[model samples]
Target chain A: MQKVIQFLILRINFIIFLFFEILALILYFSNNPYQGAAFFNSSNAISASMMDFSSNTRHYIELQDVNDKLAKENAKLRFLLSSKIVQNDISNRIKNDTSTIKKFNYIPAKVINNSTDKYKNFITINKGSADSIAVGMGVVCFDGIVGKVKSCSKNYATITSVLHQDMLISSKLKRIGAIGALRWDGNNAQMAKLFYIPRHLEVKKGDTIVSSEHNSVFPEGEMVGRVTSINIKGDENFYTINVRLSTDFNKLSYVYVIKNKFKIEQDSLESLNNLGKNESK
Target chain B: MKANDIVKTALSFMIFVIFHVLIVKYFVIGSVGLCFFYLGFLLTLSLSIPIPLLLLISFLVGFFVDLFYDTPGIHTFASVAIMFLRPKIITLLTPLGGYDEIDEITISSMGVRWFITYTLILLVFHTLIVFLMEASGFSYFHWTLSKVFCTTIFTTFMICSFQYLLFTPKS
Candidate 1:
């Protein structure tokens, strides 16, 4: 009886260890779906507050770089403003006969926490549902696109960065307008893979790539990256294009979250169209 | 454990967790190596602590770090695995006199060579598990391996040196 009791006790230890390990594995895998509200992620109030404090301490050193970026962005915006003034007269005449309306709003947010080292890289921002930030909203920086809002708590939100393994953005060649999809290969944080361009299309290293407006997430012609290299697979009809992402995620701080005013109407209309097609069938 | 030892352990635990989340977490080497200095908290625990208790301690520690790292269960999984394997490793590397005389785990208590070997084995195991899980699979096998190697060497050096420089065996 004594021997049996000791044996059972030993088995119990292994059982408990296994139980905890299995629980950890379940949490790890469930994070992949991008919908589960994870309790332990950095966007939680406590974690965000901790990171906010840390970043605040280092904010002075980072301030110079941030200022430089803001100045450059200011210059670019100034140039755009000057150019727009000249074109405004012509645009006004054209606009009087046209019905084009703005459909996107931008909410600026500060990055409280970010990591570029992991395969599933994420960024935590200071905006959340309280600021009208919602999951699936697009995030962009001054340079170009950054990521999409993944999850949000009361006052913080996490971004699924462009560097993540499963993050795919629809993009197009700037010069030729050939459409393709961009995805990270999980190797280099600076580079990503652009796929689905046909083999016959003229693509070259250094060709610029930009976001396609077909997707509701981003404005058309927003710079995504530039082609760094192109590989042709013999069996496939598409060329595997390598792109150098424009936004440096390592230095990312300030970003804008895109709110599509027409998203609800667009989604409802698309679903209605689908329903109508199904009923017609 | 005596009151003094318990107090010291609590003090060190707070220092480790605070240092990890506040300072070391930001120090990444080339987007590959991550500094998990809080692991020393678990590594330095008294060998006499029960296996179940140690596992629970590691889970909570890892979970706390995960909250700050935005990694959810990655660190927790790695920490628990290393804790579960800690006893087997200690037994395998037990010196000629055995673990009878050992109460606490530190470089001064275990000798330099023995401490290095022990720390290397466990740190490497922990780093491998963490990098692999972070990559989500063998998809980035070479990248993950390099990260494991980089982090193990960095963390082992840091932990062993910190232990050697500061830790003193308590009677």
Candidate 2:
């Protein structure tokens, strides 16, 4: 008993150090990728406020560029509204139709902090659960698709940007209608690779890639990126196509979170089908 | 003597942390490397302080920095590890006269060569742990290594300048 006590006393520092190191490792491993249990992320109160305060100072500096982008979006929205009104009149005459419900809502949020330099980058936005933001919601800017909300606190949310290594978006080429999954290779923030696309499909540089209907997070046809290059590894089943992301993550300031109204219904139906399959088996 | 040491250490600790988070954190070199002059806090901690106290202080400082940096517990892990290893490092690099007889740990108290060597060793060790944790894995092995090397050089230079220009050796 005395020997054990002496042994412990002799190596007490090492024991204490091991205890703290283990605790820290637990925190790191637990609060990653999923981030569901992460309370110390940037979206948390202290970090979010610090970033918010700094971003507020920077906001005034980029006012001119922000204004230009807003005006351009405003012009495009106005044109779309006018064209929609004409279509409504024509559709009303053609067939008196009703029953299609609104499927998506956009919640405006300002990005408080963002980084494009890391392998797994995240963007912290000023809106969180208080503003109806939730995990898994798609976030988009005026230009194109941004990313999905990974986690949320009371008044802030973290977005796992498309540049992140783990993020994969279902995408389709507009010109040739080829479908693939978009993933970042951890090299460049501006570029992503589209995988699982067959070489037989007619593809070209500058082909527009958009979010596919297959993805539950994003609405179909929302711009994802443009194909920059196609690399066909000898006799491989899939062509690796490089894409230039539409949304510039480094300069991102404002974004809109997509709230899909039909998500609940679609998810329930899918789960019910799974249940039925399980029962049959 | 104890009261005076306490006051001096506290003041320096606050300055190191503030300097790190507010100023140095913003200065990202080439968008990859960052200067961690705040590590001066750990490097300059008085040798008379106990191992347990040092561990606690390092954890607190690391936690505070993590709160600002949004890196969760990576800093805490690195800081605590370095604190735990500090005694062993000192023992290994002990001068013929020994560290037990030394008072303050400023560069002036310890000769410039010893100070430089000591600071560089601990700084590199801490930075390596931090970069590895931040990268999350060895997947970005090359990138993480470059980041570690760049930050080590940058931080070593900064710490040397800080010690030479700002730090006043206790008379």
Candidate 3:
């Protein structure tokens, strides 16, 4: 013990350094990607405002198109509301529907920051703490499901864009109920991969895919993209499907933050079930 | 001690964070990418700072990069490792009969080969630290191979190109 103490004192800094490093490694493997992003979370408002101002120039055109799209959607929504029976039927169908398990509420906002050339992709939005934007919310632009909520600040929050390498989405085919996980290969912005789908199911080109309702990030049936190619890698038991994204992420201006009230309940229940199964074994 | 150094450190830290965030969150080339992007934090720091401040600055630099990149302690761990090993890397590249402590160093003064060699060695160390941190002990061999090959090559290119573009060449 005396010799060990002397040796430790000789390299106290080194020991402390190694100690801190090991702590960091433990945190790294713990699956909390939000660990170190807490620093420099605040950026100068001047740079942010300047960025927002520059975005407004390109946003004017999107506004006009957005107005047209909103008008069309409004007209449809109004028509449905005007018919009480139709409204009742839609609500009843939603209540009775058992295929999809995910639920969501969307809060609309404008994109403040966007980048595409990097490995991890994130988008900053104008709405944040004040707008009740929290970490873990899902962000979806007109194109499709963009990504999950990463971090939140007073006036802003970052969303993990689907174009990111860390992007993982629960998705399924619209025509067939086959479900899988969605990920990007960091090669092309136009393409992503849908893996873990069993090969027994019949999948084809141009098949529409959407959120699988597996998690509370996005509502089920939200558009993802269409399958462009499929490869079965020599009895791997899963079909690798290449997907072309629907949302033109490069030209994104506005998005909606999806909130799920049932997320907590659902996650806890799932975890409990998993734990129960593990204990049983 | 100078105001310029302080401001430079703060500004550079932010840029490094943004660069790291973009790559990890957006460009994520996977295991290969995690290594390259994480190096941006350290490479940016080592470029302009005084040498004696290495261990202190490198520790904080690693910590800061780890924070922004969401890699937990990977940045902190790797950076400190490099800080300790930086002296050795410099020693290896020191021409025969020449000896200079790390404190007396900058990019322009060092010839191109020496500079590149210096940064490459640091980058290689940085990559090893990061790749190991990311790899969940699931499949060690494949992860180790991919991490080393992909990061060594990719980080070399990125570090070289970025340093070339950002720094002013001396006459």
lDDT of 2 by residue, A98-146 (tens): 3233678899999989999999999999999999988999999988999
A269 in model 1: Cα distance from truth in Å? 2.3
Please, what are the lDDT tens digits per residue for candidate 3 over residues A1-281?
99999998887667756766676566665645443232223234566677778778768857887787678767876886689567667787556444333356679988878887788888888888888888898888766888888987777778888988877899999998888999988878889999998988999999999998787678888899999999998869999999998877787777899888777888899999999999999
User: Is model 3 an incorrect, acceptable, medium or high docking prediction?
Assistant: incorrect
Candidate 2 lDDT (Cα, whole model)?
0.86
Each prediction's whole-model lDDT (CA): 0.85, 0.86, 0.73
TM-scores, all models, native as reference: 0.54, 0.55, 0.51
User: Residue-wise lDDT of candidate 1 within A50-91, one digit each (tens)?
Assistant: 988887777667999999999999999999989988888768
Worst 10 residues of 2 chain A by lDDT: A34-43
lDDT of 3: 0.73
The complex in candidate 1 yields a DockQ of 0.21
Off by over 4 Å in 1: A1-43, A96-101, A274-281, B1-171
Chain A superposition TM-score per model: 0.82, 0.83, 0.76
TM-score of chain B of 1: 0.93
Mind sharing the TM-score for model 3? 0.51
- RMSD per candidate (Å) reads 19.6, 18.9, 21.6
